[model samples]
Target: MPSLNPASRERVLVLLRHARAESWGETDHDRHLADEGRADAGAAGRWLAEQGLVPDHALVSSATRTQETWQSLAEAAGWSLEPQLDDGLYSAGPDTVLDLVRGTSSEARTLVVIGHNPTVAYLAQMLDDGDGDPTAAADMVMGYPTCALTVLTFDGDWSALDLASATVTAFHVGRA
Candidate 1:
């Protein structure tokens, strides 16, 4: 068991689903973020800003929708972060995504990962506080909606994070 006494171990990853997309596209993998999705990204960005939650690093999917969502929020915040196009994220499940984060630079604090769902929703629900507003992530128990965010905290080295150990913080959607 890892002790929760390392300040450097507090690496937070705020996982979010990109905003609503108008089209599902020809294939599920090819869908792009909709206009509403763009708006949702901005809205989420503003809300995050208000909460004073700024991620030090971001990992995004290569899908158009995911990229657009990531870019929109970055623009809204006037942040010029270099986001890597993780192909693994484009088709990974919650476990794979969690592993990806755990493999990141140990020095990086506060990471944000933007991808599609059921992974996002499942991951959130798995690491939730058990008391956040369901409306904030209403479908997480069933499914996650577009533009939803599930914030989690872990008091251990990112390399050692596990589904059973992370603490849920906020599963936010609408404005606070």
Candidate 2:
């Protein structure tokens, strides 16, 4: 994890929904990303880099598509951190995912979570404090399609994060 100034109280949380996946796999958890998904993931990464929102740490679902999305995105973004893959994330709800976020280390100022929707989408909406960029929030309301991501800023520790505790700063749907 990239070390941050301990005195800084603000933290960035990125919620990402995994890109499109092939439908013919034996199981959903084992399904891999489609060609379009790979391209979209790369696009998402480049966009994030341009925004200077590189994450210090990442939490990803153990499902193959989510793992592949993270790998492609990280490679395109030139990020060199190892992501934590949690099997529970494959089926976790918004509250379960929020609990996982709360367990994040304080050393990480920017964290990313890659998982499935509507969990990811719901979490992003749940965190909004109604004080962020109105345009971004409006865009998010349209729907969280494949490779969609939301950037939120919060004050205090990750453990203190809750509904309406964070402000949605940006929202985008990466496509290629």
Candidate 3:
């Protein structure tokens, strides 16, 4: 956990959906990212660097595809942060995801979470306070494509995270 400043009001939560993965006839959890997925993951990382949003901590799903996505992103961004891989995030719902986020250490100001769809997309929709980029919000309504990254800002502690409590700062789909 990073050192916390009580006076710091802004916290960043970056929700990233795993990149496109191949079926490979393997179990859902065992599938890995496709070549395109790898490229997109790297692109996502580059975009994060361009935004100057470096995560102080990261929570990633245990699924193979998610892990691969994280690895690709890290390599591309030249980031070297050890992320916690949890099975609970594999098929978790939006509520569960929210709970996990709320449980994060307050010492961490920026947190990046990588997970599967539906849940990831659902979390973003539920948390946005409607004061963000209108175009991005509109694009999200259509769909949260593979490797999509949604950056959310909150002025409260992690324990206070809840539905509609964050302002959507940036929402980018696909590679930069």
Q: In model 2, how large is the Cα lDDT of residue 11?
A: 92
Count of clashing pairs, candidate 1: 3
TM-score of 2: 0.95
Regions of candidate 1 where Cα sits further than 4 Å from its true position: 1-8, 24-27, 129-143, 174-176
Task: Rank candidates by TM-score, best first.
Answer: 2, 3, 1
Where does model 2 exceed 4 Å of error? Answer: 1-7
Judging by lDDT against the true structure, name the best candidate. Answer: 2
lDDT of 3 by residue, 15-127 (tens): 99999999784699999999999999999998787677778889999999999999999888888999999999998999999999999999888899999889999999999
Give each model's whole-structure lDDT: 0.74, 0.91, 0.87
lDDT of 1 by residue, 133-167 (tens): 44544545655678888666676677888765665
Candidate 1: residue 135 lDDT (0-100): 55
lDDT of 2 by residue, 46-117 (tens): 988888877888999999999999999999899998999999999999999999999999878899999999
lDDT of 1 at 42: 83
Worst 10 residues of 1 by lDDT: 1-10
Clash count, one per candidate? 3, 0, 0
